[model samples]
Target chain A: MLLSNLELVPGRRVVKHLGLVQGSTVRAKHVGKDLFAGLKNIIGGELKAYTELLKESREEAVERMVKQAESAGANAVLNIRFATSSITQGAAEILAYGTAVTLE
Target chain B: MDLILQNFDLLLFAVLFITGYVAGRWNERRHYASIRKREDEFAGILVFTNRFPPPSTTRVATVLVSGSAVISEDFFKGVVAGLYSFFGGRIRSYESLLDRARREAVLRMKEQARAQGAGMIINVKFQTFAIGGRRASSVKGVEMLAYGTALSPVGA
Candidate 1:
């Protein structure tokens, strides 16, 4: 599906407005990744494990939003936006939302 | 018992130094290489901007593309950090941690846009969060998020 944060597609025309669609997910860091993070703490560098956790969460949230848009019969999702928050010590929540529209 | 007690500090330093020099350095080099490779490969795809429509594209559709990275500090850095703390100067070890996180996040976002066949990215922004953030005596991790609107050309 075509996704964008723009209200309009420059070359295409929006023929139908399917309204809003959204998807969200909550995730917790795993022990293995946390262990790796702990090890890295001794040397000080990027935590690949936690990064993967958030990345996966984002994709999952977006995937759900896409599913919502598809159910609304939208060929594209527009004005896409994301929000993230640390819900607790080891967990986080990611939310993705957009307007679903049919373009011609 | 006396011998062991006398060399405890020495043994601790040796252990930290050995592990930090080997694993920490190895991971950093490998990660840098990976980041360099991906950045070069996606150079054309990233039209990083903060303006909408990403002028001069067919603009078939737009989607939000994002990447995130979280990294921790190694023990070797801690040793130097201790020195820097006393000298009252920049803590250089933490700089690379944040730098790598940002670069990695942006690179991932580009990869996402590429997967969707986006021709351009615009209105890019970054979000950062620290979990148990930078304190003198604790393990810390940071999250860097790179996001933007990805635009694809029409009929492509």
Candidate 2:
């Protein structure tokens, strides 16, 4: 399915608006990774592990969102947006939301 | 020798402080240099925050592109930020950290657009999170994510 974080896809016209669809997931860091991050705080640089973790979480969220859009019979998701919130000390929630629409 | 052994905690703090300062500065310099170089290389791909793509007669396909970067605060910057909080003044050290994270994220997004043969990206959005920062004191790092729609020519 085509995904665009814009009101209208460049060359595609929306024939139907299936309403809003959203997907979210809460993820917690592993204890081992948490300990590694603590040590990484000392020298201050890129945290590849954390980066990868967040990336995976976001992709999962987007995947779920796409599934929802597909179930709604939408050919594409438009005006997509993402949100991240720390739900607790070591956990965060990643959210993806957009308007599901059929394009022509 | 006796004094050093007696004040081992203080000695260790001193050693950590020096190492953090030195290494953090070096890393920041290198990162900025690389960012600048990449920025120059990717200058052809324009990025805009407007929600609408520019008018074009040629058919273009819009696709979602995104990039994220996670940067951790060094020991020295964290200490300095702590003191700055106490003083109620701007934390200059963290300014650079956030700057680097944002630029790096954008660069990654641009790289993806370039790979897809897109010359411009529009409707850009940014989301930032403080990882492990449930408490004010334990903000280990910041994560920056940039996302947008990339318009690539359908047939070239």
Candidate 3:
């Protein structure tokens, strides 16, 4: 399915609008990664563990969103956006939301 | 008990402060150098607003690109930040932390765009997530995300 933040697809015409759909997931860091991050913190560059954590979280969120759109009988999702919130110590929530649509 | 406790805490802070200053400084310099170099190389690709589409493009594809960076605050910066808060002024140490994370995210997005053969990226936006923060777990770090829709000529 096509996903975009833009309201309209460039080459396709919007045939129908299927309302808003969303998917979200929460994740946390483990002891191993925590130790790694602690060591990396001193060096002050990109933390790969956390980067992978967030990336996986975002992907899962988007995957769920796609599932929702598919079940809704929609061919595309538009105006998709993401949000993150700290749910607890070591854990974060990632949310992906968008309007489901049918385009031709 | 009180005297021993005090000494131990000071010792811990001293170690952390020195480690943070040295390692953080080195990392910052290295990242800045890399970011600058890559930005220059990727300058030709277009990154802009989503309001307009390239006129010559026959077919358009929308792609999602994002970069994530987690920066941890060192013991030294933490102490300074704690004290600096009372004065209500900018904490310079945290500034570079945030800067590095943001730049790293943007560069990742640009790299993704390049890999997809996209000439430009539009609707670029940034999102910041505190991994371990106040009211949550005590891990001091941030996750910066830069994402956008990449546009490339489909027919070409």
Clashes of each: 18, 0, 1
| Superior by lDDT: candidate 1 or candidate 2 | 2
Native-to-model Cα distance after best TM-score fit, residue B7 in candidate 2, in Å = 2.3
* Residue B113 Cα positional deviation in candidate 2, in Å, after optimal superposition: 0.6
Q: Which stretches of model 3 miss by more than 4 angstroms?
A: B1-6, B54-58, B135-137
Rank list by lDDT: 2, 3, 1
lDDT of 2 by residue, B80-142 (tens): 998898989899999999999999999999999999999999999998998876364454899
The true-versus-predicted C-alpha distance at residue B153 of model 3, in Å, is 0.9
For each candidate in turn, give its C-alpha RMSD to the true structure in angstroms.
Answer: 3.9, 1.5, 2.5
Task: In angstroms, give how far residue B22 of model 2 lies from its true place.
Answer: 0.3
Off by over 4 Å in 2: B134-139
Residues B1-156, candidate 1: write the lDDT tens digits: 899889999988889877886777887888889999988998888566666564555436566777788877677876777789888888877677778888998888888889989867887878877765345443477788888888776568
Q: Which stretches of candidate 1 lie over 4 Å from their true place?
A: A12-22, A43-46, A63-77, A98-104, B1-3, B6-10, B59-63, B78-89, B132-139
Q: TM-score for chain A of every candidate model?
A: 0.92, 0.97, 0.97
Writing each residue's lDDT as its tens digit, candidate 3 over B90-127 gives: 99978887988888788888889899898888888789
CA error at residue B23 for candidate 1, angstroms = 3.7
Query: Which 10-residue window in model 3 chain B sums to the lowest lDDT?
Result: B130-139
Candidates 1 and 3 compared by TM-score, better number: 3
**Can you give the DockQ of every candidate in the order shown?**
0.45, 0.80, 0.63
